[model samples]
Target: MKTALIALTTATFVGTAAFAAVADLDSDGDGVVSFTEMLASYPTLTEEGFSAIDTNGDGVVDEEEMTAATEGGLIPEA
Candidate 1:
């Protein structure tokens, strides 16, 4: 029973980590992740999608915006 519980816990942790990795916005394999990269990688992003990512409303995506977008899970996985 203890072994089973440990296995379940380990599985849950691994699953969570995998999901987090998938949700990460750094899809381009580049050191600096951005919403533009996300859009390029996932072409399904529309104007609304861009708007959702441009948290600062500067009309351009920066690192902070990208980080926010990534943390918010607004960008899709690579």
Candidate 2:
């Protein structure tokens, strides 16, 4: 049990770090990630791919959307 817990904690930390790495690309820190910011981290991101991940049609990808996209493999893992 202890080993499992430790593994889980490590995984969580790794995932959080990856998320933060991507979030840090938000150069403007506007709480939403713009296409330019996304592209900074993912040079291969296309207009269609970004639009698909934006989901809400808000022209920016929020944390929730980014999480979903990463988990769903729509975007490369950070």
Candidate 3:
């Protein structure tokens, strides 16, 4: 029974993490995600919204930022 409880807890944690990661991608907490939606969620984003998504500020949002935006959450990951 202890083992089963542990397993259940572990699964719940993993599921929560996964959901959070995906939620990060949804800047507005909406089901859909898009560059426009991201910009709208973060009004402070500069006219060039891409730059804001580029957390590294490398002038480009590499896989990391893309993942953060689409799966890991928003660039800022707030």
Best by TM-score: 2
Q: Which stretches of candidate 3 lie over 4 Å from their true place?
A: 32-78
Number of clashing pairs per prediction, in order: 0, 0, 4
Instruction: Arrange candidates by lDDT, descending.
Output: 2, 1, 3
Clashing residue pairs in candidate 3 are: 24-73, 24-74, 25-73, 68-73
Error of 3 at 62 (Å): 22
Writing each residue's lDDT as its tens digit, candidate 2 over 1-76 gives 9999999998687677556855687798676789888888788889999999999998988777777787788985
Better of 1 and 2 by lDDT: 2
Off by over 4 Å in 1: 1-38
Rank the candidate models, highest TM-score first. 2, 1, 3
Top-lDDT structure, candidate number: 2
Per-model TM against the reference: 0.48, 0.70, 0.38
The per-model lDDT (C-alpha) reads 0.64, 0.81, 0.55
lDDT of 3 by residue, 1-78 (tens): 999999999867766654554465466555434555555555555546565556676553444455555454344422
Model 1, backbone clash pairs (residues 3+ apart or across chains), number: 0
Worst 10 residues of 1 by lDDT: 17-26
Runs off by more than 4 Å, candidate 2: 1-22
